[model samples]
Target: MSVRIAVIADDFTGGLFVASNLEKLGIPVFYVCDTAVLHEAADGEVLVIATRLRFMPPARAVAALDGLTTMLDEIGVEHIFYKYCSTFDSTDEGNIGPCGDLLIGKYGQRRLVFGPGYPDLHTYVHEGYMFYKDRLISESIKRSDPITPMNDPDMARVLQRQTAETVGLLPHRVLHRGVEFARGYVDDQQGKGVRYFLMDCVDNDDVATGATIFRHDHITTGADALAIELISQWTSEDAGTRRRTPSPVARAEGGEVVLVGSCSGVTLRQRDHFAQDNPMLDIDICEADEDILMARALAWADEKLGAGQPIGFSVAGDVASVADAQAKFGIMGAARKAEAILAGIAKGLGGRGVRKFVVSGGETSGAIVEALGIQSMQVLPFDELGAGSCISRDARRISLFLKPGKIGAEDVFSAALEKMRAP
Candidate 1:
């Protein structure tokens, strides 16, 4: 079937999560990082274009999305979902707000609904503020994020700062009154020139309510929860049953490598938990030269891979160490250098016949995929490896488990290794 839904994910991991959620509902999804392979996605029910636009400047990110709408239009996409992080990760001069504006203009919609709620992940919008579990986002772990630290809980205020258009809130009170009242509220707000509505999605029911309210909207932007709800609503009974039988897991040969570039608390804990048994190399980006780092990491991997043991290399550190590195080499510079080193190590490992990769961090995953020259990867059925597991559609036959920094369990790394090796 031609693609009915198109999800423009701001980052790789978020896109993979959305695709995985759809797969759980038995909807076949084709996920591509490079738009050149859009033709390959015609058979899937949903087309998710994963972009590395999350960290780019607003102007550059907008420019990157310029022709994507046209491409989706040609493919018979009925709905467009702009997927972002559930934490609402963005700066005041956002890649989110500016990109949303661009999408609004492209879809010719006066108002678009924006909700960053994924209750399963303890991220949801209530009233106008975002909460991480029980605490507001300002007081949550996201406050210490190495990139785009969230210091505000009020999402409406946050979004308003990023866009020139008038931003408004769709309070939970209105939503609790049901869809009919909610739709009328949205229509009235849009009539008053509210270009974007920050929705209050505190639970699954709230997400379903938001889905019903914006069911006919040409474009809706939010985290994976909202997309999941919308996709579930759009899926017909027959289509949902078409792929209930899981595809046999693709077998992969050669060595395995785990690369962690995220400094999130969850990732750090996962790294520690995995290190208790498995071999891991901590990448020291602060003092080591890039060439020397690559040489050392490759040599280390060679020994581990030769011994038939899966190994991990990490640039993950505590907040103090991350701050120190950022101070030494500005934030973006430090991040770029670390990503470059990890990407180099991945390339070197791939050359040495390492085919299964368990990668952590969104930017890190993007870099490794780009370095490996992988254009498109099909999202595999939801497995124990959790959200972002996929097999490359290219000749390499590589299997990858791409985990977002904050979304996995303490044993996620070990779980990923086991899942990738399953027959």
Candidate 2:
């Protein structure tokens, strides 16, 4: 049967992250990172596509959604979930708002629910305000994000700046009223021309309530928080039949590499933590020519892999200089060059018998997969790092640990390495 659920995510890591959540609940899920393989047939119940549009312009994001929705419709997907970061990562002139509006218009779904509160991830919503752990998102370090800084904690105000549609709220109080009451609240909001509702969810139960109430065909938007409940509701009755055993972990040949490109404070800490146990090399792309940088990176990778030692390749400098790179090579051009270099490094390492990789940073992972010619990958929950292990679709079946810089523990790299080394 055709997939009933299809998720359009804003980045590579987030797509696999959501798929891993559903997969663990016994839902067969196919995570497609490259759009070219969107039509690849699968026996799975869900298909998650990584659009990597969060970093793009608003118009581009909308256009991408248009194409993705059309493809999903052709593939007979009955339900749509537009997944973004649990932190509600986006700019005032958003990729989230515009893309969400496009999906609403395409599906003729009167109301779309927006909740980025994944309590497990410490993201919560209170009175329509977004919280990171215990602090309001605006009060967090994300306020100084290099690309799309989140300055507002109010979900309504945050989305209002991106679209002309009326933004409404599914208050925490209404959620506690149970399914029917919550469903009525949604209808009431729709009557007031609120096309988008930011639903408040403080815990798993609240999210389950929202999921139980919404129709399967209704278009929902959020991180994987709501997905946990939705998948459970869909398969609860047939749990025994739908469930599958966990796949066996495979032994990794050759050495591994953890590539760091993001400049988030969390990534900085992770880099320092991982470096304490592994050899870490810094690539100074800004100071050298592209050719020289590539050559040096390859030489370093060769030395590490040749010695059977796990190593890390980190880009030197912070994200504050992103504007400088953009000024030098235009916004999109800068992104392209960065991806190109990272992809080159991956290709060089992979050619030299490196079978496993830990690619951090959303854009970096996306680019690395594409450069390595991975059209599609089977996603498995990697660890408590909130990342995913991916096996390429090709015969090589290369193994990868894709982590979005901000996610994962201080010893995430160590955990990933151990898993990869596990037989």
TM-score to native of every candidate shown: 0.96, 0.93
Q: After superposition, how far is residue 308 of candidate 2 from its true place, in Å?
A: 1.3
Candidate 2: RMSD to truth: 2.3
* Per-residue C-alpha lDDT of model 2 across residues 1-423, encoded as one tens digit per residue: 456677788888888888787767667677787777776746555788876788888888788788888888777776788888888887776788888778888778777778788898888988988888799999987787666677889887888788888998888899998989888888887887887888887888789888877746558888878866776676565433356655754555776888887768888888889899788887656556667878898987766766666888877347656777767777566666767777888888888877888887888888888778888777775356565787777777788888877777888877887887777
Q: Each model's RMSD to truth, in Å?
A: 1.8, 2.3
Q: How high is the CA lDDT of each candidate model? A: 0.86, 0.78
Residue-by-residue lDDT tens digits, candidate 1, 308-387: 77889999888889989999999888898999999999999999999999999999999999888899887876655669
| Best of the candidates, TM-score | 1
- Where does candidate 1 stray beyond 4 Å? 237-244, 383-385
Location of the lowest summed lDDT over 10 successive residues in candidate 2: 237-246
Give the worst 10-residue stretch by lDDT in candidate 1.
Answer: 237-246
